[model samples]
Target: MTSLAPSGHLTIGEHQLEYRMIGPSPAEGPTLVLLHEGLGCVGLWGDFPDRLAAATGADVFVYSRAGYGGSSPVQLPRPVDYMHREALDVLPRVLDAIGFRRGLLIGHSDGASIAAIYAGGVPDHRVRGVSLIAPHFIVEDTSVQSIAEIKTAYETTELRTKLAKWHKDVDNAFYGWNDAWLDPAFRAWDISDHLAYIRVPMQIVQGADDQYGTLKQIEIAEAECYCPVEALVIPGAGHSPHREAAEATLRAVAEFADRILNGHGEAAHGQAA
Candidate 1:
């Protein structure tokens, strides 16, 4: 397949998602598919994708899901199973559309959970491993509290104004994620079953000071996954470790991608599931 442009829109179903491609094409080497956080978009990723591609010597693809960035705006009040739908429905089409031969899925927050679900649910042998930053396996009271506070901030403060620089329809991106999580039915949302079924190595990076979730999220991965699970906890960091601890986060993620994509992946992974 030919290499993708530096940036463009991908028409998936009715949605036209925005994306940026860096480094080699999938045919040249491995690829890294970055799934952004609930409110994150391709623009919000900044130059992290460039740094990652340079560090790993692999293609880096960053995209904004529906309702975020320049992507098509989704209907408000996304389903409680929104992340699940992204993993099982949207992400696969994305990977296929890009002609991804083999690679890693690096995700943040909600994106991390979706990566977990996809790696475990899809039978695609092309995906080598997963790198999760501040992943959520199950909902927590603290998570709810933090999200509520953010909602308050978005509504009363300039958070929406700041976020508007990224999303064309900011309210759709904000409420789509905020409303679903705050919904009472979403409290029971647990994706641990997906963790148990993952057959590839998994690396989880977390912020020690993350208010949205606790170390219990990593504990769940350790308990449920039969595959190798390595945790990297960054001190004095919160929710988005990649931003709070930029250099360290980039190095760690790049190293993990290198290890897994190269022939040494299996040696580090132990027994595959």
Candidate 2:
């Protein structure tokens, strides 16, 4: 699959987000937005989104948030509202600036949660659907422990050095995400309350062995969400199902998007058949 060379920059309020667009031209097909994991940027997503867009025939848009990639970097000691800032304020701006009204969202880790928040807030039925990989509403102790382990490994092993190549400000991005997540204040961060408002068709893809979240997260979202939800638990896969089982995850998302776009899938649960 060919890598994407996306034009960057979409302004939101006073801030500009750096973005890339891939796949078939946005004019020819449905657009699918790709949201990266906590420590990810356009570079880290590599060629997966390109392959996915090819398979689905959807134009793909990807970006780095403030302080992550080429976008304007935030000074250190940023507030916890940072994630909220991206989800509530930044995402819409990017979509609107690019003139994509209806599109599929493919998000991983923190990005998945952001997609959920976006889907819930927009009242318009203009959104075609969303696909979540390793999403979370409430942070779990298991996640914390796993994160602790990662931090330890980063210090003791080569993980930090390896990750440094992918991030422009690697420590800034890593600690900015890590410290806030491990903070006690973050445990209370739950978006399950907003699930009922999301009416777009969605697919939740989780790894059975995901170290960051439990299956309860998926169960809660599916139960609370008004939209038709499909859950896929890939056995033996960990946090990054798309990375670990790209073919399977891509197939599931492709079929799900096809169903929704073709009007063959149920929209909200119990509203119709």
Candidate 3:
């Protein structure tokens, strides 16, 4: 495995992606790779990575995709198939770049979808399980409506200014995700087909009141996946259960990682303080 700095930039193709490695390295133990939600970057995740690492005992890897955080900029009006491209093209390179040996993918929203696409589409044996929080297997009317509303907030409120702190190219980060979802053709965007291909056990977490998606996403995973599937629904939370319900979310993710990685129900790794 490559020697990783605590935090630094990784050159993957044309982009220099910003990343953080918390706790143990891949060579030391199992790894948990975090895929952030749309409009999210390394900074937005705050201390969640360190907390997750402590809870799971496995190393936690977090990175900002192109155009997010301090990473390189990407073309505007991102392709509707952008998630697919990231799953099939960029994420593989990232895993290889980090010398990932064996690990699980823990993704939120867009990142969740990307992980599903990668695990389902790619036959990489290194990925042992997938945990999705507020994932979308298919585009929902709620998703489109929420995205449109956020765009309005970005223009009319301080949302852009707040996000600007994390993204070097805020508009690129915002519209790349915003414009693609709003595109009429994107309504047909669905990756539930990917569910049928996943071979590993799966864990899914969602808020009871996630504005971006609904329980239907969970139903879709249960209906299509042949692998073992488990889910957690955090009440009074929104799209980001990890933020809105941090402690519960951390415990769930930690337990799932421990059980799947160690072949037991108990957490084999020591919790970080």
Candidate 4:
């Protein structure tokens, strides 16, 4: 895959966030800000964000959170409140710096969790919609099992080394991600209460074979959210649908963005099964 163009950086609060701007020259085509997964950085997205922006004629803003990729490294260990910081503090500042008055949120894995919180915190006018790929609500046996498998691979194979090349400070990125999920307080974590507060349209894309999140996580969000929601479970896909099934992921996001921009008034998408 071709590399994304050099990304721009903004000094949001104490840290400088590394963000890439791709697609049409203007920010007019309904911006879709991509939130990366755990252990993911702007480089980790490969070509999918560019593909999605190209497919939908939308400007996409893909960024690496603090301590990941080219962003400012984390000086201290990530606190339990880190996710809260991203949602409540960092995201708003990013939007303001980019002059993002309104846009859709496309988040995968941990990014999805952060999007839910950020969207929930803001009023409807600030957000157009949200689309989630392989999202999680709370940690599950399945989730833990998957993490264990990843740990095994990291310990016994070259996965750790491979990932380290992309991250300047891989230990900070890896431990910050792994430890946060494994933390005891994270187990009781549930975003359902915040879901009700999001008035914008929402879509969730999960893989039937996703090792991290069970179907119940998506189901609960669909059932509880006050606004219109659509869920799609792609067969044979796994935890990272954007990588495992990039074409379909881009298509779904394009359709969702189209619906929102065209003034569909209500959410509409093919159902999940």
Backbone clash pairs for candidate 1 read: none
Q: After TM-score superposition, what is the CA distance of residue 58 in candidate 2 from its true location, in Å?
A: 1.0
TM-score of 1: 0.95
| Model 1: lDDT to the true structure | 0.91
The residue pairs in collision within model 4 are none
Give the Cα lDDT of each candidate: 0.91, 0.78, 0.91, 0.79
Q: How far is candidate 2 from the true structure (C-alpha RMSD, Å)?
A: 4.6
Per residue, candidate 1 scores C-alpha lDDT tens digits across 1-273 of 367777899889999999998975765678999999999999998889999998888899999999999999998779999999999999999888888998999999999999999999998899999999999999999999999999999999999999999999999999999999999999999999999899998999898899999999999999999998988888888998899999878877888899888754322232111
lDDT, candidate 1, at 138 = 99
The regions of model 4 sitting more than 4 angstroms off are 1-6, 24-29, 263-273
State the displacement of the C-alpha of residue 136, model 3, in Å, after optimal TM-score superposition: 0.6
lDDT digits (tens) for residues 1-273 of candidate 3? 466899899999999999999865776668899999998998898888899888877899999999899999998879999999999999999999988999999999999999999999999999999999899999999999999999999999999999998899999999999999999999999999999999998888899899999989999999999988887888888999899899888888888888888876753221122
Clashing pairs in 3: 54-272
What range of 10 consecutive residues in model 2 has the weakest lDDT sum?
264-273
TM-scores, all candidates, are: 0.95, 0.89, 0.96, 0.91
Select the stronger candidate by TM-score from 2 and 4.
4
State how far residue 235 of model 2 sits from its true place (Å). 0.5
Poorly placed runs, candidate 3 (over 4 Å): 266-273
